[model samples]
Target: MQMNGMNIKPVTVILLVLLLVGFYYYYYYYYYLSQYRFNVPPCPTSCSTSEPKDRVPDVIPTDYVFHLKTPDHLQYSQPSIVKGRTDVVAVTPWLAPIVWEGTFNPVLLDSIYKQKKINIAVTVFAVGKYIMFLKNFLETAEKHFFVSFNVHIYVFTDRPKEVPKVNMAPGRQLTVRSVPSSNRWQEISARRMELIQKLIEEQLRKHSDYIFCLDVDSQFHSRWGTESLGGLVAVIHPGYYLDDRGKFPYERRPESRAYVAHGEGDFYYCGGAFGGLLQEVFLLANTCRSNFEEDAKNGIEAAWQEESHLNRYMWINKPSKVLSPEYLWQDFKPRNPEVKTIRFSGVIKNYAAIRPNV
Candidate 1:
């Protein structure tokens, strides 16, 4: 209708209102209902709550003492047997690198290739303590990567039964290897060295081509598939310090071989989530012994924790590929623009309610 010098359309007004209503509904459905949000509780300052006291004891004694040998003494070997044929083999080696040069050759490609499978191995202690986080980790991993390709999760847990049964993809498999529990979670990485060594010797000798060692306390939030694979990949540590290396917290000791050798490096990487060619990891795992022992002597069980040792090894022996910080991230801080994805998010939870006192 024409009124005065302007034209008014009743149909246009009605159409605009409908469009606004439709947009609101669409936003609400996708933003809130479709996505899964985890509500992380705040951590307490003091150790009074169920939180485990950070008792940095003078030194914890161990029955077993490890000695580092020269490169000549160390063996450069190959996989003893090849059980299954796979496009890419993944493994997390703590110790004992079975020779596998004959089984698979380390190929450096100019561009990324299609990955048929990804294998992840985690060294777990009391499953009951971090069961919730482990469950979430497995579920998130499957959602982000396993759905698209064949993925196998191998967990070396002290208590396998405590691990819940979650749905996995068609080619997905979860293998649980029994381990011993430790008084401190930090010590698990060190104490389980023997267990991991044995497992690699027996099971992972020639099973996987690529391997990732992950902490059970982390969860997956982004796409972490074959694209992240290479000769050696280390994620930027969420707790890395840009200033003086001394200011950097965690189990960093300058006198230690890992830190002392690489005194002037750009950044320190976290061992929570790391991947590499099976041969490279096996070599490092078998050779990097001095740093691990030095950290143990100072009453440091896991020595810079595991990541510290890994950083030192990488410093001395630079890997072919160095991944960005997005690979394995922690929930201690907010996200950064440079971060493409986070392999693990440490959701704060009630520790006392979950884990009992040792």
Candidate 2:
């Protein structure tokens, strides 16, 4: 093409054509092509630096996914050839294989996971009189809680000096963090999630592989060990495990995000004791903390506070394992025969006196 009687060079026209082509290819390869076809790895220091080996699926299904792994050569419902227990059953489907005493071989599991030196982060808060329960809790934990696996009991309390110095066994430790004292038990319970989220992000995530958020006013009585480890674990609340799912005390307020309609819960998990992989526990704690904050801002606290939020999250996320009521028995209730072991029990408390402005 000619402009103002000036002859345009064929080389100039070719160069312009080449520049346009270059721009088109660059845009396609860098922006459009990579997003549609490539799995771009994160750069160092941004987050996860590892490159993905497989192409990520385009669409992830919304339905719950459960993965169960049993010990060698034992049928799901059949009698255990090694232990000769005929009552073994696969409860909770893929969410969590119910961990009973006869269902697992402690020695065999220890030999396998011990090499990993699994660092368990057990977090609990003792505000007010709840501090008194720490001694028995720590002593019993040393005796039964992941005895073979490396364990660190992180006690969050207003009085660090009050935290008992229970003799720790090999591969065990106790850490006390000073938290603000609270008059109300409900306030203390709700704040535990926020404190845990902060700890996991600042410290626990770096040092611990697994994290357990447990109520401080409880003591271990039997083996609570490696068999409970999973991507995420939730314990069945002893009071409501056998009750109809319709009766679960999930948040009933429609405006709250924690609301769960009747007949929706898989299990009524005790907010007092729950845990999982460090990352997953971090997510659970952070999410529950945020949910609690939102509820507070709206001037409507859920009946059970963080516990309500937990049930909502578990319904959507579906924990990898669902621990039976045996994991959290109460001293007040008669021991059910079905509960082969009472690994931990809630100590009797003066709820009226301990609670503030009740």
Question: Candidate 1: deviation at residue 210, Å?
Answer: 0.6
By summed lDDT, the worst window of 10 consecutive residues in model 2 runs over 56-65
What C-alpha lDDT does candidate 1 achieve relative to the native structure? 0.53
- lDDT tens per residue, model 2, 1-358: 6979998999999999999999999998776655332222322342111211223211111121122333466434444555544564545655357776677777666655765556888998888777888888888888888986788888888888777777888878888889898766778888988898788767774577788888878989898988888767999899997779888999888777688877676878899999987666766776787777877888878889889988887877678877777788998889887777799999888877766657
List the global CA lDDT of all models: 0.53, 0.76
- Residue pairs in clash, model 2: 95-320, 96-321
lDDT, candidate 1, 1-358, per-residue tens: 6668778798977798999998999898666544322222232342112222222111111210112122323334444465533422233233212111122232211012323233444444335476556787778777875344555677766677778788987867788877666666556655444454455556664455456777677777765554455556666566663346555433455555455432455457666666565545544554344446655676554355566566655555555555455555667777765444465666667666765553
| TM-score per model over all chains | 0.60, 0.77
Question: Model 1 compared with the native: what TM-score?
Answer: 0.60
Each candidate structure's count of clashing pairs: 14, 2
Quote model 2's TM-score.
0.77
